[model samples]
Target chain A: MIQRPITVLMLSGLVLILLIGVTPAAAHGVEITYALTPVQTVRVEVIVHDLAGEPVRKADVTVFTPEVAPGDAPAAAEAELSPWLETSTDRNGWVSFVPDPALAGSWQIAVAVDDADAHITLPLAEESGLIRLASDQGISVMSSGLQVTVAATPITTIQVALHAQFDTGEAMDEAQVVVYAPDNPQDPFLTGTCDAEGRYAFAVDLGRPGVWEIQVRKAGHGDWLKIDLDENAIEFEEVPVDTAGDADSTNTTVQTVRLADEVARSVESDDGLSSGQIVLMSATTIWGFVGTALYFSRRRAATRPESESDN
Target chain B: MPRRFVTLVLIVLLLSSALIALAQAATGTLEFYANGEDFVRQGFVSKDGWAISFDHVYVNLTGITAYQSDPPYEPADEDAELVFDVEAILEGSYLVDLAEGDEDADPLLVGEVDAPEGFYNALSWEMVPVEDEESDMDGYTLLIIGTAEKDGEVIDFTLGIEQSYTYTCGEYVGDERKGILEADDYADLEMTFHFDHVFGDGELPPDDGLNETAPGFAPFAALAEDGVLVTDLAALEEQLSEDDWTLLVDILPTLGHVGEGHCHATLLDDVGETAE
Candidate 1:
């Protein structure tokens, strides 16, 4: 694996499950007590990527841990948050933080780049030697569900082939596909179904150059993609050109498609599946990826209580 | 041994579930903002080739609420009701100026509320006429004061609208995911306005969906006098051609959005009934 230089905010926030070493002769002789020491080292990894599954590197990452009153942590409502760590993402657009076992509470991370900002909150705590993350702050490490990945490939100047599939590498067969033209959003310009390979190819008349959207839905999940046709991408046949120069035409219409559960955009291309052909959707325009930051943590097994023999 | 293992597993499950429950029970601040985007803050050209610049654009909004939706909300879904676990409501109307800041300024804040910690994905807001009868902006939900120039002809214009709309939107999709409020942490949700929908963007292909539906500034420029045209939707409806007037009315409700995403804009009449 290639190691990219990403600034890491490692939060060592866990308790190492320790065995209870009790004195065997406590009933007849002197006894001793033990403290519940926090020794578990839990690491939370935050991955910030774009729709293309490419990492958004060099972005500034600011971590704000909830304020605790020394031994008496205030209630969530009365707590005032202060920045616990400030760092920038590495080349992989990721940061790693180990929760402060002493500070066992929620942590808020703000990753910013340019005009885009992604805030991810993870309620991390080291309790009873078990480290658990917030319910679901864009982290679904358990489910083997479908994750839709939309890729565009131009078949012709006006025609494009859009591919949709789960990150599990299964094609979204028979999924409903709806295309809405840039201007007429209320009505569908074209509607079709994906093949067994999750590919839906369609063609249209190039009357003008603008953004086009394709919404793909399967079962209860939905995902969408935006194709920006620029001047160099199409041949306009007797249509009025934009008089505002190329400045305004750069980003015509912005379409953001977030599906129901875990709106998956993680495209794992390791299975020989090609990815990031979105440039085929736009010639001059760059769809800057300002996406969600995923917070993930791997918990260790809890140690067994002391056996009777140890006592 | 199997029974003991099952009991231990059950206890762990209960403990973890309780921790998750405690995490979800926390509360946070959810900030709401109104953004005209660069299209209004910096101005743009109308589809008909008019370079426009704004001085002030005021909008009256009420019934602002955010929802923590499950199965998520899709505005494009027909008759889709927001199945939310919690809804954070800002219980008051507010008058906001979209063009109140510089080109690089942040969006204007509408208000903030103590909301449950969750992904407040879907949002809803209503645009009503200004309630103050004595103010110049009264009786209007939208007021636009701008200058449009095309082909050496300049027109100083103020477009006012008494029409009202209630926009129901899904999760905000833009440079980032919004409305994810952590305990004691704040997240922002925005109401984005696409003015290009009204006057058509001059920087796009003339046949683009947005420009095709918009009547552009050409029709409004025709209503100018002595390089000035200040009028309301009612006056423009009388002066503009039937097609242009109809298109203007169709575009006004669509002016509200959640970032680049569109909302289900329901036009309401004077009696707050859904207009035909």
Candidate 2:
């Protein structure tokens, strides 16, 4: 009876002490959670803390998500001092992001607080409450019966990429892709055909902030994503490179195999003429015109004297 | 000198002169003008002892054509066999405000046309309600806003007429003689819009001339008295009976000057000199 009483008292005391220590641990860890919305927007949140178990305010958190198809290995998540959708933790050590459809994927959030970095990849589970991870690969075949995904980045020119596959799990290429504002459905603001890779990547200048829809169709099946735009959605804060700390102090990287190599290689032929190539082409054409004009003028001048002498 | 060289030099000079002349005679300009006459507001005396004054007079004028006659016309001949070839002129509606007497304003110059250089003898124009999608002016071509006073009572009238009339050279020949156009000339034709003709008598609506059976001016006149003011077209339509609206429609064409181009043209003799 005496042993039992003493053991119960010691166990109760240890439990009380652990509960008291848990409060500090909770405030000292930077935790991030996110939801990959079916509407093609990524909702991300980050809770940051200091070593002393205090909420670290304004800690820079850079989230990088390399867009990859289902079953493909994500590229190495390098420590980017200026990631795409970056934000700072508030007084509650919390920061969130509902990234635009252009930035939807398995986002790797890299948090740097007090020269220490932490990373997390969302969504955390195959079937989280917000993201329905139906595939071992992070492929979300939406309930709209379209096996396609949309990804975007908050750049001056929003780069949107569409990855589509047929019901037979084959890449659907040369699909008819149309993007337009809902209010102006008749005017297909952007219309193009998907390449042989079942990928259509294009840059659009979102002149105004409003909801836009993308429609991708192959055969008779189609996929759509409603993109919401706002001031917070189109802008990002770059992560600061802490020159005062160790260079490799917070070089944390996290990646998830998102899509298959077959899907990724299918869109390998998507490279088109770059802006520099276009400029070079225009210059060459102009020089060719000048050279042709000079040659013809010289020939005409040389022939004029012979004609004059004959006359 | 060789005959061939002389012939070649003459041919070059002749060809150059002919080309220059053809280039010079390529186009002729016609300027339109409005004549409010003595029947304008503030000074006009109606036949029925009422002192008449017009505020606004809007007329839709169209189908203005210049004609090439085989022989020139006599203004006062008893019988003249006149044949004319129609030349295209300006076609548009113009608001002729009797009160807007500014010479440099747009109201003064109704329209202007650039035509090919040719001798034009007869001018024909129609004062008609617009029947085209180009304008909303229909039924009555002219809208006359005026006030008449006799004794102590004042009558404010919005006289509407839906009549369409084509006035050729004969209708405009009397009094003011026009219908001659010179090549490379700028013709300035002054159209006379007589407000006195609208109201035959000083009567609120003249009793005669305007047919009253189907639709005419007499019924519109019966709708008003010597003291009431009719404001706008909507107000007039609201105040008048349905039959009176039909009468207004019938009388609209007959309200203003049927001979729209009651004019005299100042033909240009030289490039800058005007033949008065």
Candidate 3:
């Protein structure tokens, strides 16, 4: 056999070098991180992560909002300097900001991750005055359940539309709807009942801009629901409801689909869904993250340790 | 156990004793005052009657003396008679009468009088009024004298008269029924009568009139001034032997006076000592 010492030496050297180099590389993985420059200035948060689904730390980052040019090409706009970027992340790899005179519109958080780059855009919108109520199946329902809304201006008048149904899911006409002052449950300001379509409309002069509660009950059934004026599932509009008939009809429901279409068409003539869109988008984003985190954590735990080792 | 019972008994006894002592202490005392003074001494009546005589002869002392027959029958006779001129002191109107004890004896007047209206006579043969006015000492002294005789010779003699008076105390002044010689409101009177005389008689009358012929006298009349007399010297001696005049003097203010409108007499026992 030819002398194998040289070959063995070469192999040992290669193995030793590989072990020495890979240890540091594995310990220092590519990470992408960004943080607000000033601390606690506005209600803004910055997040960064790597492709491996791990929080990226110590990443030089920049932020921009997307703008449209005349050529129909996307261009980067100079970010309006946020007032709340005075702090960096701690050892926990987290950063937060509360922008003074907070920024409006979309905020682009871009990160440089160990020679690789990624970005996230958070569409910042003003707080919504909208509230929605739906049945258990995720379809919006108007069947004897409560909905509430808050207003941006000092409220002068309040309009309430209700649809009541019985235990058999049949429309319950002539159900009494009483609007009470929120703090005092006994003083009912308005009393009315549903029509043949299980729909009731009440007009109330709120006297002042404040929270109120509406109570709906079928004449014979004990089940009733209360809707607070400032709850999350309703929309408060300053415009007259007749001006937004189509939107109102779309957002509202009666016993029949034909009636719902009529109502929507009536509400469509007014302003678009202005206040309700912000609240809906926020709710969607929050629920998306919550569902994603829950699924990721549960799926990670349920996978076998042997399967992960093989990967 | 016995000790406790004894203690209980002792406590009960102590309580009862204290209650008894408290009850006894609740009794009050009675004090008697004579007039306004506290001292009352010897008090009594004089000895004498309304008349006096010497035999059946009537004699007169034309110049305090008289002449009579031979050597054995000396003219200077020490046995003389005395009579009390009782009428001169009778300021209140009264009646008088005379009667003889026998045929040989001279007829004598011995009767009572009617006391004047609204007046009380102290000296009268009878009819003693409630009070005597003339005897009241407004710087006046009453002197009465008399004499008696039998067949031109001095024979058996008697001199007697009653000195009576009225007295008053507060609102009680006189008794209308009794003459002046009888004190009215007699329970309030304190009086004393004194007599001074010389008698050649054999024996004096008893002071309290225990012996016959010696009229017993009421030594002290509490209210009415009846003929309260001391008939003999022995009784007077017995009363005055002790120095009890201070007690009588102390009682004088309460007893007050009868006729004199003051103390009737200072020497209360002397009246009973010289009775005949």
Candidate 4:
């Protein structure tokens, strides 16, 4: 009986080991957190994660402080004087930065995983004096860094693949990607979830040849990236000229404005009756009155003569 | 009383009643007919000495009116409300295709109107293009399919024109041209459209003015035959130059001759009418 229990325990442990081996790792991403202390000093924290949700240790974090106010035209500042503050994440995937307590304007923080190509802009509000996330698509709050491209076209079949990443160049998993076709665009053509390596793909047969728009988004993110594709070309910019016919057909809405004003004005100005018209009008009126007078007089003459002859 | 006095009184009363009846208002059917019905059926010779026949001619005849006053009947103000007491003829789009010679297709209805029985000095018509989305047929405002042949050399031409024509009889009145509306009667306002005038002398633009070979119009033949054509206002505006487009729009309405396009009102009982 004891041997049987021991065998059952061994099998259970083996099944647990197999389960752990099969489970996917967390998606590669970055997270930044910040809080203000009672002393009015601000401390910013940065955390990096691998695809398996494990901490990514020793990633470099760079911080840029702005000389002007937040929400102002970035170009008007002319130059940023503050030197970049740099540090690396510790063993627990955490990095800390302390700004001068007297300096209280906006600050732009950036994180670089390894090389300068993989950099992300961390979210910080200049006025709120609080560190907040600008985007939730990946570790970085800025989603504008994502690059999208189409496969190929003449589009017998529609297929699109997206690589989700932060501005810092870290791959992001679990991001939502949706594809929309020209026809039935109100509904999604297909929806996909990113794999461990921060990649999502979709494919379907399309019926029409026109512009197809795809949207990529992450949870808690307000805005998403939009990509357009033409059936005849791999890129939207290379769309064929003949495809504009569909656009021509759609611009046929009825223009309710009357189209004859200019012609009427010209006719009126050139040949419309002026003084002669008045004479004709007077003639018509006089003739009408004359006819009435003649009728009344003839009736009176005939009636008077008849009455006189009878008397 | 003497018989002579009684007869005189009766005669006077009869004369007054007749005068009153003649002065009273009357209603009639204002009929519109094209002059080239027979020519459309049988091929007619063009001015270029070529035989030509039309396959279709569609026009939207709307906003018909008759004015009792003289010419220069206050230039039409599109935005102005209907203040002048003008007698309206047609209320909706009236289609007159000479090719469709069936019983149901003859004598297109202008409208049923009630007006004083007299001569209306001015008659006006507003002909706008047929829009595709609003119409069941092909969006061609005017589609003319014909063949011109000279010396055994044949040229098949198809022209689609989309333009709005607003014209009044003021400029077209001859010494005796007038429209008469009688009580419960049928009258034919014959507005004859001369296709020859459109392609007159086969000259190009700035020469013949409104010809098939005009810059914006020549492309219509090929596009229509290919079964991919839309001649809406915007399309024409885009295709034609400013001068050519303006020239075509200005000259098209003056194509009909006065007598050919004048009104000829007839009594309903005079002939048994065969109209739909």
Candidate 5:
């Protein structure tokens, strides 16, 4: 569905997560000490406005609290979620609702101003006593772009995993992959195809440090990612960090961010894929590091993102 | 050509052919649609008691692109940051009449594209003036020719809106989920325009948000001249009062939706009549 600009209604509020523990019952050599974890509730102040910054008066405001606390959300099925409270913004566009204070995470808030509608996310911090979350766990600069083999390990040489997935939750398996060095944008640097997983792997010759471009194209659709490699390390440039497609197709979310961080740590602590080859390429006297090993560190890839994500 | 050069050319050709084959194997077709809903087809009474029926509702669309997202794009998320790599784009401009079929007609099909197989959850569309000033729809993005009758009096009306809008949305939110394509399979997405939001549904309460925001056919009927009215938003703005003009402009952006879902719409200032 197209989104109504109701997002002009900015929701800001003070929030806290609370966990209440019931006293354990002990009777004649038996002990019941299980702690009951309730959902979280945080107070919020919602201010609805039009794009012109004028407060929208008498608008209907409703908030949908998360049915389960963070880390406790059901893996597969969505529980029956319902509206927490139904209220109206005052003349000043000021309206506040305290959720039953149960779940600790993000809550959904909707406002119907005049006839236009808006839906906003009310962020609840993790510290707000949100039902003491279960343990949860991504890589170095490791989100949706290539890695320079610099963030984690100390090797000059590196490997890149270029991922091509434009639609939400789906892989661009077998996409056409092409590489272009900064020196020649018109001619091809390297030509190849992605594996069945929409990923193309290649070793970045950091020894030949220069800005490199990788393009993943399929059917008439394609995108470009820019990689800058210098003496300090590899830095991603002009890469889109957000996405356009958000369908529930993959049933899994790729943690591109921190993927690099994780890879870096792994190299420092020795985790994930095995490290490979150290070729001694003839070096230029000014910048000579011919013996730096090339290890297979994974990288994230994306180029075009939706305009909405730009903000 | 020398043997070394000839051998290199052969290798390049073979590699290109292999990549093309791989792309074909991973692709499918995705279709795009536009729907004016029952208000434009079956016709409905405006909240002000005007019976309105459309003979033609032409909308021009362009820049249609579809994409797959990792976290699943929620068009409703205000602060969402979207990321995507490859995506399907339906290039060129297209014009479709929402009143082409009968009352129970299916949504109008705009076009289709060969896309990589993925769960395409997000889409974008734009409405611009038809090309060439000589054409009937030229210089106008939206054209509505309809009839409205109230209290035994009939008025033939032609409402031409020069305003343009770009609607980017996430997912289809109707009976069944759409835009899920498998290799060799076909999927579809829809761009829905809720005319009721502009005319107001008489079935709904007078106090309803849609009705309150809509200017209703009553305002247009009052602007009718000798049982026939053909005018644009500029003329209407001058003829209608300040409150009515504001109400109409506010309602215009609310016209587009995705199967009961909302879209993020931007009124293009550089195109058409250059609306304020």
Candidate 6:
């Protein structure tokens, strides 16, 4: 009986040895990790090793972004990945993948090695802002060949004066002029060119209160001006003008004084005038007269010399 | 259990032994042979209708061990004047009587054997006329005799003869003359000379410049058999126009010369076609 038991033990030992001899050694699975950046790309690296810590070769590997719940599988899982983005390691047993236009926000990456699996979650962020646009001087003209202005006060009624002069410095009869309000540039508040003496004037009614831009354009030349208006604000508060002088001798002074007054009045009124508008109007009136006078004077002078020579 | 293990080991050993024995039982063998001596003969009719024969005969004995005489020629005694000195004999020739085969067959004569002197140590039999007309049916025959002995004395020997014949005639066209102008109705004409080398030499002579009084050697210059000079320009013009003689004549000078040593001629129906 004892011999039988001994034989059974020996048989059992032999069976154990055979099973152990056939058993396969454990294989170390690969672990892959990824880092992503906006405007750049995400990089994935795979590391493979055997149970003995020796690098293994010919290990089939694949990597891709995982699908989300209740949705179709990600396209990347089914498509051929870019060569630069997908790479297998040389005999050394290392592989890497980089996502072009790196994924934004959270992304899950899955990596498989010789049937084993592993994954990593990557968080990507986009770099912040880079572009802007604004006006240079507080006010700008629209495309209609006119002037515009922002204002602090409401402009109720605005009056523009007229004056004229011939090339010989002699005053003339009539002139044409055109003026435009910011609200309606196509329809001018005033229209006409300078008359024989080169002078013009007009007035406009402010429909409502707010910043208004006035535009002054020479008829034939298409030259124009734009000015911001804040009716509640003061204009000539910055300029010192001499208001005492004979209107005739002071014409030059008056021109300057009137411009200053307009500016002040425009600013003080419910619809304040833009400093730019006051300046442009004053300059236009004065220069219009001066240009006409200079032109005629030179013409007369040139004719006189020719006539004299003919005589 | 131990007995069972021992029995299993014996079974594997026996199986392997059987497998080895089976592998050794299969066997195979291979063999090879060299080509034998060969020869061929051909015949053709010349453009001028003369019977011509071309014989290309060779002996291949790299592996043959013996040889024998062909056709009418039997082995001659050692003292015979025309005894074939195999050591000195490289080639041989014979003539066939073509008339025996058909009444209309042209006569074929063996004129001579032109072989390099000293190449062969013996002079074979004279040109014997074979009585076999059946043999001449094809206008040619090849006969080979010799033993292809590599390292031993010559043994069994026999002769092989292959005969062939081509009924078409062989013709030669000469170079054409350029820049010949004639009246519109007087189309240019060309003369072609044709002959067969089997007629021996001097059948045709060199060409002399036009207008020369000497009789020209051109075939068209003289009628075959009669040797009459064709000098009538009107008749020549009529023949030329009938055969588009102008074209043929123009291309005659450009056909250059054909055949080595011998000359022949052909009249082209259209010289322009020939030139193109």
Cα displacement (angstroms), candidate 3, residue B260, comes to 99
What are the RMSDs of all candidates, in order?
Answer: 27.3, 31.6, 67.0, 32.2, 25.2, 55.2
What stretches of model 2 exceed 4 Å from their correct place?
A1-311, B1-27, B41-43, B71-82, B102-107, B116-119, B130-139, B171-177, B201-222, B229-276
Q: What overall lDDT goes with each candidate model?
A: 0.61, 0.44, 0.27, 0.41, 0.57, 0.26
For every model shown, the clashing-pair count is 19, 23, 87, 13, 45, 64
- What value does the lDDT take at residue A192 in candidate 3? 43
lDDT string for model 1 (A150-170, tens) is 111111123355566543344
Model 1 — TM-score against the truth? 0.49
Q: Residue by residue across A1-311, what tens digits does model 5's lDDT show?
A: 33432211111111111211111111100010111111223335566666656776777665555543433222211352334445676788766543433345655655665557655544454442232222221111111111101111112124454555544324566666566555554344455565566655554444445555555555323444444443212232221111322222222222123211211111111111111211111112111211111111111113224443785
Q: On a 0 to 100 scale, what is the lDDT of residue B193 in model 5?
A: 88
If both were scored by lDDT, which would come out higher, candidate 1 or candidate 3? 1
Candidate 3 chain A lDDT trough over 10 residues, lowest sum: A16-25
Please, what are the lDDT tens digits per residue for candidate 3 over residues A48-144?
Answer: 4444445556554443322322221113323323211222333333444322112344544444445654444444343322211111121111111
lDDT measured at residue B107 in model 4 versus the true structure, 0 to 100:
35
The estimated TM-scores of all candidates read: 0.49, 0.33, 0.15, 0.32, 0.47, 0.14
Residue A17's C-alpha lDDT in candidate 2?
Answer: 7
Q: iRMSD (Å) of candidate 1?
A: 29.8
Q: How well is candidate 3 docked (DockQ)?
A: 0.00
Model 4's DockQ?
0.01
**Order of all candidates by TM-score, from best down to worst?**
1, 5, 2, 4, 3, 6
**Sliding window of 10 residues with minimal summed lDDT for model 5 chain B:** B70-79
Candidate 6 global lDDT: 0.26
